[model samples]
Target: SQTIHQWPATLVQPVGSPLSLECTVEGTSNPNLYWYRQAAGRGLQLLFYSVGIGQISSEVPQNLSASRPQDRQFILSSKKLLLSDSGFYLCAWTNRETIYEQYFGPGTRLTVT
Candidate 1:
């Protein structure tokens, strides 16, 4: 069975600080990883996607970036943050052999003040 995990379930930061959020997937190989964000009362927005290591696609253009250091690990980072960048960040993965069914992590809720 595969599982996805995210850290810092909740975060509070002042504007202009750096940010790093991580996600890891277990029990799968060569899966397609994704990063998403959902603002309060809004639909999920795709931020980034990785088909493999060193191959990342960005769906949203912001002050954020993602990296896949290992087969099962994905990291999201920001050099400097803004108040408008606050939201619930989620990580997900879909197995290529599983008909593209995605499984998501618990998520990281961030608030910038």
Candidate 2:
């Protein structure tokens, strides 16, 4: 069975501070990884996606960046968080052969003060 894990279920940070969030998957290999942000009462917006190590596709250009250094590890980082960066961050994975569905782990809600 495949499972995903993300840390720091909730975060509060001052505006202009740095941010780092991590996500990892188990029981799968070479899965397509994606980072999505959802504001309160809104749908998810894709931030970044990785098809392989060092290969990331950015869906939006903003105050966020993503990296995949290993097969199952994906990281989201920001140099200086903005007030607009406050939202729920989610990490998801989908099997390369199956694009119809994506599995999301527990998300991290971030508040930029």
Candidate 3:
């Protein structure tokens, strides 16, 4: 079975600190990876996505970036965090065969002060 993992399940940082969040998948190959941010009581916002290694698509212009250095690894980073960046960050994966069925990681809660 495939599984997705996200680290730093919870985080607290100042407004200008750098941020790095990692996500990895197991038991899947060539899966489309996605990054989403959900504000309290708000719907998830697609931040970034990758179809293949070294290919990243930004859904919105923000203070964040994503990279896929390996087949199953996706990283989200921010050079300087903002108060508005505080939210629940989730990583998900899906393959072409099961594109409708996206598997999500446990997610990380970020609090920017």
lDDT scores of the candidates, listed in order: 0.94, 0.96, 0.97
TM-score of 2: 0.98
Model 2 clash tally, residue pairs: 0
Q: What is the clash count for each candidate, in the order shown? A: 0, 0, 0
Q: Report residue 62 deviation for candidate 2 (angstroms).
A: 0.4
Model 2 pairs in collision: none
Q: Which candidate order results from sorting by TM-score in descending order?
A: 3, 2, 1
After superposition, candidate 1 runs with Cα above 4 Å error: none
Tens digits of per-residue lDDT, candidate 3, 1-113, equal 89999999999999999999999999989999999999999999999999999999999998999999999999999999999999999999999797988889999999999
- Candidate 3 accuracy as TM-score: 0.98
TM-score of each: 0.97, 0.98, 0.98
Off by over 4 Å in 2: none
Q: Superposing all C-alpha atoms, what RMSD in Å does each candidate have to the true structure?
A: 0.7, 0.6, 0.5
- Pairwise TM-score winner, candidates 1 and 2: 2
Model 2, residue 112: C-alpha shift (Å):
0.4
